[model samples]
Target chain A: MRVITGREAVREALREEMQRDENVFIIGEDVGVYGGAFGVTGNLIEEFGEERVRDTPISEAAIAGAAVGASLLGMRPVAEIMFMDFVTIASDQLMNQGAKIHYMFGGQQNAPFVMRMPAGAAEAGAQHTQSLEALLYHIPGLKVVMPSTPYDLKGLLKTAIRDDNPVMFVEHKKGYGEKGEVPEEEYTIPFGKADIKREGKDVTIIATSHMVFKALNAAETLAEKGVDAEVLDPRTLVPLDMESIVKSVSKTGKVVIVHEAPRRGGVGGDIAARISDSEAFYYLEKPIKRVTGPNTPVPFSPVLEAEFIPSEEKIIDAVMKLTK
Target chain B: MELSEAKKLKMYRDMWRIRQFERKVDQFISRGDITGTTHLYIGEEATAVGAINALKDEDYISSTHRGHGHAIAKGSDIKEMMAELFGKRTGACKGKGGSLHIIDTSTNNLGANGIVGGGIPIAVGAALALKMQNRDEVVLNFFGDGAMNQGAFHEATNLAAAWNLPVVFLCENNQYGMSTSIEKAFKIKDLAKRGEAYGIPGVRVDGNKALEVYDTVLEAAKKARNGGGPSLIVSETYRWKGHSKSDAKVYRTKEEEEEWKQRDPIADFEQILIEQNLLDEDKIKEIKNEVDAEVKEAVEFAKESPYPDKDEIFDDVYVDREVEL
Candidate 1:
């Protein structure tokens, strides 16, 4: 029973996994002596040595492709693409090779590698701040993980490392400093399972990554207005827990999906479509609403940036509109 | 580097096997027996067979789109490869990966990549894995002259050189990348010189000469295995056929093709074998007949194999897991 920042939770997961398995090594641009751009890999090289904690050139493709190749040879590589936006540079290796290797090779081999991508708007301009889980989730052979809390981050990251498929582990940059209680003992959360942060009946608020916190706060405000909101987090997007999503919506009869990603072709659209297509279609009392970032790139100005990200007030407004 | 008679004969047989196999593939494609596209490795047999002959069975290899020769050189079953091309259940990748993506883990062949330079970094990674585990093994990475222009080629080569990973970067300069000639792609005459930027040793050899390619690769592989780091070797060769099944080959003159065809890798090596008394007329006839029979059997096996079950279309997308998607 200890409270720690989300960053520390990530480091702990990595250290524990590295200690558990020798094949699990960290490779990225600044993951070595520099301790990562966000300080998530601080002092890991000191413990794991430079060999295990590898420092590569500023080559995202090589980092990703090398991880894929190493994973095929029985080594579990945890590759970090410093920012989510830079994943585009490594997209071919991650999407074309890593994601398709297992399937394309007819299941004879699998690249059991983890690519850690720090995402979300942290006042950085468009290039450095973007949630790319939607892109990864669209790929068939990849598993996408986005955790909002320190406890969830530690458990889910450990699971991602052990997973036999390519995993896109998206970490919210803004939530790195957020603190939450995590147990000292070892545990791992399974993929495709939903975590109901707050249980209610009037409406279901489905959120991902940093948006989950806003949804939780909005549920608190909704309770004050005498309208109960259920908060559900489908932590892993690829093996999405549609079962839990439909079950929650069946009881609430209303749903509102929220995320920092842009509205156009966002994961929210997919979730909304799935809900409407599922047996829960009859349970909907109102059209499923989405509170998401606009289709434009993330702005740099503080005021515009604040307006860009989904907020607790916006979630409350969506819930109020549905309930009213 | 004196090669034994047995080794010489094996390399000769492997080269002929690739030639016959590629020729059969051309016939199959023309006859509409195989759908989609395939990059034939006809003229480049010496490069694949010679370089791969230097590697041990435990060593790994990463191949390119035109990788049938690499698969055969690495000792993959031709039956499985033909079946894979036929999209049958008993194929190398269970029909998931066709000609361009054939993978045989049993022989340590990393799947052939569809992207030009995509397999380079993966091969580097495999070498990195070998180094991390303290294994004395090297990975032979096969790419084309066209791959030299790809970002992946630079990134992967730099990483391999920096880490001193046990890998040999073999560039089979087969003249053209689809329709674009290497002359238009690279400013430099020798593609091997690109290794200077990465601080790795580079060598060039007559890819038409199987013995020369074998010697060059053997040396590079030994250097890599000794922790000396990676080497880049440019095997100057050509493709006898067009880039793929759809290519009409309008870009090059028939005279140029005929000129290169005269320096055929198989015939050149066959001449050497005869001169050394390692092979005679009877032995030459015997090898051709044996290779032809093998190709015939492979085609028959592929024809008799059943297509993958329709219900299993969703299979092999992931390992050990079933999803709703």
Candidate 2:
């Protein structure tokens, strides 16, 4: 086992996949000699050559559309959007074309491309900071992946490349620097599975991406307060591991869903609805709670941004309300 | 660039097939057998047939909303196309894609896009794939005058030129982009010159002349296959019918429509074949009868095909993974 940053883990996954499959290539802005805006594709061009590690002009629509088109022709292209917010510029290709191509074309073709987007608030102002996983999750054909640790990032990214469908791989900007243990041997995690970060008995705290760490911290504080809270991460949003979510919620009978995205139309609401709609409804001792960012643009001020992103205090507060 | 007699006759036959197919589609829409509206390729048949004919059978093509002509030109089974328009399980898209999205991957015909300029980047990507694999096959991207305005066209063309990918951008300038004439939409008369901005060679041809289009595209495709990079070919033509079935004849004058109709590509090509002794009156009538019979069979096949089962609606969203709805 080796400890590495989430960024290094992603680069490793990409390098390994590129070596395994000649069809795999990277296409995006600043991915080649520039190494990517976040440096997740660091020095890949030096090893794989410019052909496999393509650097494109500042064209988001074409980048996404090219990935879809190349995928239809049997190329596994991994397209990178510098920021998640810019994905809006590429939404037509991702939503209208790539997401609907397989179903619309009567299964004659499938767009097996991975669109890597760096998301979450990083004090980069309103336009640059936003978690758009909800937007991608709503699309039927897209598989949404958001990993919390280096291990998950490495495993899930490899799986996304091998998937025979469009995958929106959302990486948290702040989580890139976070370090975790990863095995030296190759591995891949399957979709539709949840990882319980911390096992507990009194309450369940569901989170995703950067929010997973916040929930874990909140669980640590809750444990000292004599309230044991379970922390669960539904790693993939589209093929949501509701079985794991409902099982944890049924045992605890109290739930708090946390995410960095805004509360209105957020994935938390969907999880809440699913819990209420399932057999877990009878086991609930309290109404489901949500600790999410308010419905407004992320602020530029560090203090405001700190408040804008859901914190460990917010998670603990929401959990206490349900537990007490 | 002399073409064989068989190839010339095929160009004429494909042009006629598109004309006759579109005419039947008009009848089907009027009779309420086809529900959704379609952008008929009545007058611009030569551009599709001629450009597609210029490519090898293994080459690929990306089409537009008015795509029935391109599909036929690229050898898609008309029965599947008709069944798709009729919304049956036997359709090219299994009844999911209507007239707007008919795709036949078996024929290397990438699906027709409902969005203007949407297929441009996809074609560029396909070309990118071919180039990466070191394949000699080229891709012919078919779009309209309207798509030239889209940002996608600029982005895709630039990428193709920058990478020297094997693709030919064939713009069918059939006058109007849904009521907006090219005169009002573009400042320049020749849309081909736009290729200069991306540093690719541009050529404008009379779309009514099938042989001219074929010659121009053949040269471009050859250059692309030889690693000379992408080119832009603008085929200036006109759409005889309205933009769609729902459009009333109000944008242009009837005199203008009749004037363009006088240069009907099918009739013009038929006359050329006759002059070359490639076809005679008897052969022309026989070809018409054969095409008419084929069109009739396609209609009957489409009419008899079953609608997709309701439960099958959940299929094809993903290849191997099933998502919980």
Candidate 3:
């Protein structure tokens, strides 16, 4: 019903959720007064006041630690990490404490919170460009979500806000500016459900975040080459939609898992393994292919950095190898 | 000296309970009945009992890894704690959290953290919660001397001081952090000075004396409740045993241990009780026996309790995990 960029969708999600719940508040560096680093929280401080939209000192540990502590006391806190790379500074609070609290306490408490970080490669060099969704997904008791479209971003972010468990919601920096038709009315996308962007039968192309766009682009190119590819975008990584992948793999009899993260120990490997383990293996006419970044740090140079992330050309090459 | 006889007697009883409980846990852990590393609070009973006694039932306390004494002092169920240490299904955290993670939210006793200085920020946050809620309750963050050097300690202290939150940062400087002496960790011998940097009043108290710690905490708690902001009470105490169950006490000599043992908190309290004629020897012995029996009953209950089911690992991760498309 509405046409908005991914950034606007995220801003709307935070605003709506903050307005809906009294206990909910946003805290991060430059969130208030200066607005968020990505401008997603622009003018929110004026709207919600400084109490609800707080700007914190540059302490990831403190921000995350306070959020965890606040969440423990029945507050729904949404913390922002300016870049996904900086989350390393607060990994202790995130992985050791936040992720373990609910399970360690044996259900006595839950860290009902959301951590928003701008992830993926754009112009930012090696450190800022890395997408570490796979690392977070590896941890238990955490919901890791990456939304591709504005509609999914809005709905899924709202869902993450209300979720009782801690959610690591990673937004691609480049995807934020991408325009999409988001509903004027409110909506929420469920976790672990795969969205089939364009259904085909030649190969099951599973992607996430920015890679969804690339996969769709590759799908169009593959159509010209007479190779129909079914593109599936799984918004969440933790509660992954294995059924959708398995079903598509069953029909297509070939698969390609694509992600922006490094190929070594990447989510693509996990998806490929699941497909192999599932009953869909019998239908496989060709072995599964995984299109991922190389096992190295994201490069500083734009050309090398672009190579570090998966590309549509590589997807096309992998698809041609499988389709042949 | 002007404290009521009832108050004096109650302090003696709680201190006796903590001493008895720690001793029993030591024996149980040594006998292999209780699994995992146990941090005994044998010599530092006064620090926990006295400081905790100063707090109200609703007041929150963030505990350290050597937290059994603090937990017991904060009114956590001994039975559940014992069961948890035994890794039983009916434990405080359903046996997932062992000796170090025992927590009872009902009693406002936050979970003991494994990482050193981890609970400081949590305590500060809890105090901030109280402030936001406009509640009169105060938070007592219990840490050791070694935690003073941790980044979390500095960050938490600075934040608490800046916010003027209702919290008492009770540093139980028990001579050593594991085997490393506090003297070796810092240039200044005085631990209270570290708190002064944060612009809050810091007090150095005799950790061996229950009355001293009790009075100090009473003042701090009162100040916090009255919106006077946070204070640091560095209680200089000593641990009777090594840092953990496996420690051989290689760092300190037998003489050093013996010297501190002479000023034993329980013995010191017992002497006070006798001198004041508040509790006779027979009454003290009766209290000790009652504590011993209670500890024994908890051990029995833990031994009888069943281990948690294997499938429980997947459960309790979150409140809900609905499949969404």
How much of the real interface does each model capture, measured as fnat? Answer: 0.77, 0.80, 0.56
Judge candidate 1 at residue B170 and give its lDDT.
Answer: 96
lDDT per residue for candidate 3 within A75-182, as digits (tens), equals: 888999999999988777788788888888788878888999999888777789889988888888788999898888999999999988889999999888989998
The TM-score of predicted model 1 comes to 0.99
Model 3 gets an lDDT of: 0.87
**Model 3 C-alpha lDDT per residue in residues B1-325, reported as the tens digit of each score:** 2567887777777777777777878888889878788888888989988898888888989998999889888888899988998899999999988988889888888778888888887788778778777888999999988888888888778888877889999999988888889878889988898778999999999998988998999999999999999999999999998899899988999999899998998889888889878778688778878878898898898899999998786767767745321
Docking class of 3: medium
In order, the TM-score of chain B in each prediction is 0.98, 0.99, 0.96
- On the 0 to 100 scale, the lDDT of residue A115 in model 1 is 96
Q: Can you give the lDDT of residue A30 in candidate 2?
A: 94
Give the alpha carbon lDDT tens digit for every residue of A1-324 in model 2: 679999999999999999999999999999998899999999999999999999999999999988998998899999999999999999989999999999999999999999999999997999999999999999989999999999999999999999999999999998899999999999999998999999999999999999999999999999999999999999999899999999999999999999999999999999999999999999999999999999999999999999999999889899988888
Number of clashes in model 2?
0
Which portions of model 1 show Cα errors greater than 4 Å?
none
DockQ, candidate no. 3: 0.55
For all predicted structures, in order, the TM-scores are: 0.99, 0.99, 0.96
User: lDDT-based ranking, best first?
Assistant: 2, 1, 3
- The residue-level lDDT of candidate 1 at B226 comes to 96
Candidate 1 lDDT tens digits, A244-266: 99999999999999999999999
Q: Which tens-of-lDDT digit does each residue in B1-325 have in candidate 1?
A: 7889999999999999999998898998998899888999999999998999888889999999999999999999999999999999999999989998998999999989999999999999999999999998899999999999999999999999999999999999988888999888878988889989999999999999998999999999999999999999999999989999889999999999999999999999999999999999999999999999999999999999999998777886777564565
Quality of candidate 2 docking, DockQ = 0.86
| Ranking of candidates on DockQ, top first | 2, 1, 3
Error of 2 at A12 (Å): 0.5
